[model samples]
Target: MQLDSQLDSETGNELLRQAWVQFSGAESYTDYCQYWLELMCTRIGGVTMATLVLDSGENGFLPSAIWPEKSQPDEEFTALIEEGIEEASGLVHSLASGSYGVAFPIRLDDELAGVVALSLNVPHIVLPEVMEQIQWGSAWIELLVRRQRGKEQTEQFDRLSGAVDLLAAVLSEARFQPSALRFVNELAAAYGCDRVSFGLTKSRQTEVTALSHSAQFGKKMNLIRRLSGVMDEAILQRGVISYNAAATDESQLVMREHAQFSQSGGNANILTIPLHSGDDYFGAVTLERPVGQAFDEQEQGRICSIVALSSEVLRNKQNQDSSWYQHLYRSTKTQLQRLFGAGYLGRKLILTSIALVCLFFTFATGTYRVAADSVLEGEVRRAVVAPFEGYLDDAQVKAGDRVSAGQEMSRLDDRDLTLEKLGYLSEGAKLQRQYEEAVANRDRAEAKILQAQLEQNLAQLNLIESQLQRTRLKAPFDGLVVSGDLSQRLGSAVEQGEVLFEVAPLERYRVILWIDEHRMADIDNGQQGRLILNSLPEQSFAFSVSQVTPVTEARDGGNYFRVEAQLQDISPGLRPGMEGVGKVEIDDRRLIWIWSYPLIQWVKLKLWSWIP
Candidate 1:
């Protein structure tokens, strides 16, 4: 038995340590209490079940946590407590004839806050030593509850500190509506209120701009309004107010009205606490309890503490906002004075003159000209290809060599052509002899007719010889020979019409400008512009917009319109296929209007819709 007692002591101490850790780790007081009751029932062997009943004042003993209660306490259990039975006098009682149980009152300081009831299965085994251990465990549980309360108080203080810091930040900055509202919402949730709201006095009207509520209560805007009204009244009176009642009591007519309001939205018990800072009031926090529950003094004190913290924060925030506005006004006034001073005005005039001078220089110098980068191109040019199917002879002009119009670019082998020409000449000579004989024998009737036929054959042979003389390929215009080389490509067999050389004109060039779609509307046909070539950047040439294509094409994921500009002053070195940028002098508008045109259009559209 002595060994058993020692074991019991060790077990109790361990359980106490575990309960202490759990309670300290608890996020909230309600959670701590629930964990404590569950741990106690689990640790003690004989105790088949346990429960915690909190004192609800006039609401009587309210069941908070229960392990194995078969049925809920009805009016009879409430009557037993109300009648003040001696067995219920902060002591243990036996529920069954042979079963023993213990009841310990949970107190804050000396006042009874709640009761913990534990029951054992067998009465015969109810040793004094075991009872003592159970009592010791209950004491530790009570200490844990007290520590949990202290932790809650610390957390509440921390929350208030955070709210103050947030309020201070909001006051220092004028645009703090969002941060302020968030702070108020978080505070209300931390305090376990059914609904919390903050009303800021705006133009002589109290507008509840922020609100929050417990998860058990659904979102109902009317409850928020009612609570706001209560707080507003309290703030006007400059004090705190609270309401608590049974759901159906006549003495709680206000509570009944609220309860009815809540029932319509599926909520029941309700409490509202007004918040005040010094003599002034800012808002109120309201809490709703589920059915058959009421707020006691401890809960009321907690709610009041939260409201008090919020009220002070709101007042500080208001003062900060006022100071911020004052500072901003003073700073703005000082800036305005400096901006309108004579020195500033003179500077502005000088700057405007400089800007105008710069703009004039840009236009006069043709610095904004369109001079496209270009490669050598042909003008009225054609490729000197093989005229007839033949082997190529030595080419007269190589690639990049300049050739005059009608110059021989390349020649056919001409050996075969020469032979054919000679053959045609020989045939013509023979036919001519035959024709002479026929003329001499003109008197010989039928012989003269044969000679006439031979004369026709001679004429045809001469025509063939003339056609062979024109078969050599030649340049079509005065240009550079951009394509074939004589030394490299000679003796190569070529077909008729195959390209041997490309000739390009030496003098004229055009600028193809890529104008962005955004600036396309500002461009006009025939607008005078300047061209700047990358190759000859030092020289800017004047030009005029010759053509503006209405259709837009995609380039690099953006739309651009093709614009053609003709150079007014032709440079000697300029050639076809050169490229450059073209800056057309479109109609000028005010700088401000150009920048804000899109925003103005959007606002106009919005206002037009608003009018309807």
Candidate 2:
């Protein structure tokens, strides 16, 4: 606390450099404050005495360092310090001892930290210079305050990070005992403790459950009993407890058990933290170390935070370890509370709305229909075939074209038939003349033979003429050209009996529904239905099911049964091969049943297949 009385420019500068080196190297807050006060007194000179007053947070402004060892602050100097702190600025006032007192505030970021008050023996004219020097020197104090605060903040951040990491490790374990063990072990390693133990409140008494660095321990061990006693002390106090063999008591908490345990366990320092979740205090954690290693306020706070965060996770694992019936009972109780609870009005309203909707669907009845893809088809389809082996000479129509009965669809080449007919005629004329000559000359056998030849030739000519008449292909009825494209095959060779055109009657139409085999049971003869064509989506036609084919046909990645339904009403716009959808009404069923029956059936089938 002794300071040099130097005021010359060179001396002051040299002292300032020395003071800065000491201030920067001081190890603790009190040491640094002492250095700052000594430096200030030395640089300003004629300082009778000076005291560095620093902010002690909850304790208010308190004297940290006094210049000139063994000197204490009198009433006048203390009043100056209070006034300067109150005004948050530099202040100068006269003391009753006829000396002038100066107070300068040390501020960090516009907030007053403390005031440095001095009783100086200087001329009135030099007072302004003193104030200037005091103000200038306070910058170092402010910088030190900021550095210390930043260091504290960094330490707090590191503690928070470590607590978060330990909580994650605790949650990662799948059981209560293991998670608790991990927590205690990790906390011991992180905080440099010799041993850490956790205990839970069971049957209104605390019992040691987990121990650091030990997987298992007997319940009857004296150490476990002592640890449990320490935890119980903390739990009963309902707060953190710290015990130091070297320090005096700071609080009126009951520390009898802590003292007993420490005395028997190598005179160790002990810290016990209560574990609470929400409003219930359920457990405690105790950490121990050798003498001189007492837990500070910051360490206690960090350990409490870690315990608070991981408590619920441990409780959940404990609950999961219970019997199945207990789990079920808890689950049922929670659901019942949600259903009939006072809070959660929004949830209650939502659940009520859902229940009303489900109720309506469960009891309401509606028409149940089976839907399938359908196509328009004629009742009877007729095909036109070539009569004789010939080459196609002309084709006038193709598929999807409407034609009347007897309409010429295609014609075959007839030049060979015409030439064969001419040869037959010439031979018949020759046979006739030969027969007349035989009859006139009295040759009966020869005349009869000539007559037979003439008849045979006439029959052959008639057959040739009949063959020529069938060379032109014609439609059998007024219908749509269902499957023919002879316009592109003109002049191609055709064999006899080769079908060249297929025609379906336009007025008599039927619907061909390709129902999935899974829905085949819903279809039967005489079931009324409605059809919607893809081309005419705005309109619907009524129909009645006529037949359901027993055989299944595979198409479009599934097996389907062909269902034929007679059209009750017809439109001229409808044509064969027009595709549409058909829905056949089965019966009136509940709306839920109508919607969910298919899914239920599919699930049943899957289960049946999986069973055996």
Candidate 3:
């Protein structure tokens, strides 16, 4: 009896040691229960199958894990196990009524959580002690389940935290697409996925711009085209599609189409997630896994979070791009306006202020020229008055006629002058005949000498008479007859130096502006300006600083300086004495300081004078 007792104790201890090893080796609740069920089946000699069912309380017993002799359990068996927990125990008892089987309840911290069932194909004896061991093993499995769940939760939290960090980096940096793509690719690789693709929706069409991707199978081009074609529809729908462990029929088709396809590959799966910012669906991320390798809902949810963060980064980048473009556009427009004097930068107040500060001491002295309007007049224009007191006989030109130097404009009535010239010619002819006779006879030496002198005198008289016949008024140079209209003044005899006509050079012209002395301080030589003619209001002619007279003439209750601007390009119909207004550009300043600059200058000057 002692020897038998020792052997029983040794056997019991060994059995317990084997059971502990199996229970401790389990990595998760499912593995632990599977091992425990297998151990029970092994202990029962006639057992055919064993299974661990989780109790749903009011729902039923759901098949958690099983070990079968010939094949895996069928859907019918699984359904039976999923029946209500109270009914499940009865159903199993009835199924094994004539056979050898036992159903043990598994308790987790004193609450019945599940049932472990073992079926024997034939009747067999089960020791009471062995039943206790089975019960104890089931309890230990429950504890492992809870511990495994805690570890999974902890790991998931860490993964999500890392994803959040990546998102923060993407949003903060300027160029984030590359970094985002790299991070996503790393995620795909970690999950053992074959390929990863990222796309963004285009505005005008059902297309997308492929942002980034990992390896593309041989059908990469075709896949890209197809994805791009469906982008609009996907964005509008904002849905996700996941294929876990591809169907056998579909796998065949995929293998034929994809170049990198393998038959022995892990479970083929595809997951797509939409990235959104507010109401806008930016795009989607696609993850591809090989056969037998797939992601669960938890993994998919984590990927969705990453997609959402990437969308925000893309939105910010687009906004930055738009802002930069707007700034560049405005800067370019301002520069062009400055280059071509077309807009407000060509205003008068700004230009005049600029000229004064640079060209004159008015800004320093607190005194500036005032502005005025006056009829433009020039000192260079001189009236071409009649030189000799005579009538404007035979007026050949009108008031507006253009003439050249030495061109006859009119002829004087020289009838009396012609008669005097004829008499002188007749006397010269008589003296020439007498001198010829004395020379031919060679008589009286003194008479011959006198005849020779008379011939010389007659020759001089003829030359003088010819010149008197050619006296007709002519233009001195190419000019316009501006002043006296010979048509109205014809035959009107006037004293010498009396104004008959005024002529001015055709091309030469100036703008004689009556710049107020207050503003004249800025007007100086070499300042640029623009002239707007009253006659030609539509045209603005360019001119530059030619002369700024120092003396100010009193006009319109103010001292005004005569500013003369030289025209650069002469327009049609421009002549001397044409009326026009001109703006002289002195300097350029910031748009903000135009009005205050003059006041500031005045105040500074006053302060300086007071201090001195």
| TM-score of every candidate relative to the true structure | 0.39, 0.57, 0.35
Q: Of 1 and 2, which scores higher on TM-score?
A: 2
- Superior candidate under lDDT, 1 versus 3: 3
Best by lDDT: 2
Question: For candidate 1, what is the TM-score?
Answer: 0.39
* Candidate 1 local lDDT, 1-612, one digit each (tens): 999999989988887788667766877656766767767765665676667776555896676666654545434344334433324345555554355556665666665666676666655555455455655656755676577668767877865666565455434544335545655556545555455556565443356656553323323577655655554554554444444444335441234345445656534555555555443344554455565556665666655655555556665555565677776885786566666654578767777798896666545432222222223233345666666677866667787677787887666775775776677677767766766776676746655665676666667666655546555677777877656766776777877778777777776545667777756667777888777676777987877777887776787888887776666777776765556565777655555454456689779889999996
lDDT of 1: 0.61
Worst 10 residues of 1 by lDDT: 366-375
| C-alpha root-mean-square deviation, each candidate | 20.5, 10.2, 27.2
Off by over 4 Å in 1: 1-379, 443-468, 482-488, 514-525, 547-554, 558-563, 592-612
For model 2, which pairs clash?
A: none
Q: Which ten residues in a row have the lowest lDDT in candidate 3?
A: 252-261
Give me the overall lDDT of model 2. Answer: 0.87
Candidate rank order under TM-score:
2, 1, 3
For model 1, what is the error of residue 299's alpha carbon versus the real structure, in angstroms, after optimal superposition? 33
